[model samples]
Target: MTATLPRVDTAPAAAVKRRRRSLGWVAVVPLLAFTAVAFGLPAWAVLDGAFTDKGTGAYTTANLTASLQGAYLTALVGSVKLSAVSAALATLLGLPLAQAVVTSRHRALREAVLTASGVLANFGGVPLAFAFVATLGNAGVLTRHLDLTDKGWDLYSFWGLVVVYLYFLIPLMVLTITPALEGLRVQWREAAQNNGATTAQYWLHVALPVLLPTLLGGFVLLFGSAFAAYATAAAIVGSSVPLITLQIADALSGNVLVGQENVALALSLDMVLVAGLVMAVYLPLQRRSARWLA
Candidate 1:
């Protein structure tokens, strides 16, 4: 005795598909409009200006060439190095903390930790700078309490800048890495242990491969943040450090730099360089991410 075949219901399925397709545009249109206005226009302006000669309709490389001066080059190099180092430090510091939080049984504690991290991550610019200054500056609490003439701690130095940068970077790393670590499967660890794999071997073979892409992506984002950082460095060091952002601001003010037009051109060139670097990293990362998802 053969079983009867199940009835097919194509009409309802098609109707549901059509309904979803119809409603999709309602969400799509507004998002498209907002993106075009807010992001598209500004990006177009920047790109256009990068290629165009302000004085002449014909294009010129003079602006770009001039921006590649020793001082500007040094600033760019310093910024990239600082960002990379800071992000690396954050990753090293945050990874274990993320693993601990994800493996924790205490839900309340996890939430509390995450909340605190979120607050700190959002605390950039003047407030964060001021906080660091208050803690470690000349008249700061730490300075007043601990006096050591031999071991000098200056917030104006490159290392001091990095310290402040790490304060912000660490929180960002915690926020980014927590989700990636949480996504890791638990059985893998037990399975590795069963196979006589050491903790380092297990992580090196399994966990690290999965985590690397996300870590790299997070690092790029952190680098962008550090590179674009203006307020924090400005507030703490008061243009004494002479970062790219501070230089740009000075140029924009039209009072400090020798030539206002040249300064503007230089800033535009810096903007282009930053944009190019971001795109260079982001495009490959996006493709790599897609492969991981697949």
Candidate 2:
């Protein structure tokens, strides 16, 4: 009664590992170059310009100081308010939509919604603003037919801008939250059911807790998206809305307020700070969600 031990080959695996390690830089170099050219240079330019004087190129804090005052300050506040409202609305609406898509029995419906979301999420800027204006603006098709203007529906105002933002923000939220929703395991539901938990109880206690981190992360993501939206808002409302992006454009192009390149860069610096804060919150939340989801 003898037992035999099987032999395993190591040379092929070792050679493959060595080959992969050697070839790894093939991908790394291009990515590094792209990052340097695309992100690094732009970031350096902003940092350099933010403190430098437009006339002498000498270092000063006047631009940054000016950016935090008067109309520029108002623009910053308006931008934050808009971003928060849009992101909040998007997160609330998109969660249920994502849930519906996830829980649906029909594969075709799920596929269609997901496909539509992917397209619509990235479908912002001029064309989208134009479409909305054509459909809802004064003298627009819907406006002419329904007389929405008389009924106090102004499509070029603040609330109107929020509505337009919702168009893309909701879709972006759907795409962002869908994966997190899918990460909700069936076994967890079954376990809760076995413990005599109702559907509501199961969700409220188990599901919501697990999904909270993801929800927060998604909110942060949506916030960043809405905060950075410039072209769409510009096309629809222009300088009518007191948004930081518009303010920056105005200053850079010498349209109004503080018309200076350094001031524009300083405003951009403020934007970078806001984005940094968002990333700071988002990264931790993502890590937490990953642990639970995994």
Candidate 1, residues 1-294, lDDT tens digits: the string is 999999998999999999999899887999999999998887776556555566674666665665566666666666667777877788788888888888899999999988888888778898888888888887778877886223788877677888998887888888987877876777888999999999999899998887888778778777777888889988887656657776667666765655445445556567667857876886687467546544
TM-score of each: 0.82, 0.90
TM-score, cand. 2: 0.90
Screening candidate 2 with a backbone cut-off below 3 angstroms (N, C-alpha, C), the clashing residue pairs are none
How would you encode candidate 2's per-residue C-alpha lDDT over 1-294 as one tens digit per residue? 889889899999999999999799776999999999999999999999999998887999999999999999999999999999989999999999999999999999999999999999899999999999999999789999998999999999999999999999899999888888899999999999999999999989999999999999999998999999999999999988899999999888887644487899999999999999999999999999999888
Best prediction by TM-score: 2
Tell me the lDDT of model 2 at 73: 99
Best by lDDT: 2
Model 2, stretches more than 4 Å misplaced?
Answer: 1-27, 257-259
Error in Å for residue 44 of model 1: 3.3
Q: Show how many residue pairs clash in every candidate, following the order shown.
A: 0, 0
Whole-model lDDT, model 2: 0.94
Candidate 1, superposed: residue stretches over 4 Å from native: 1-27, 51-58, 258-269, 272-276, 279-294
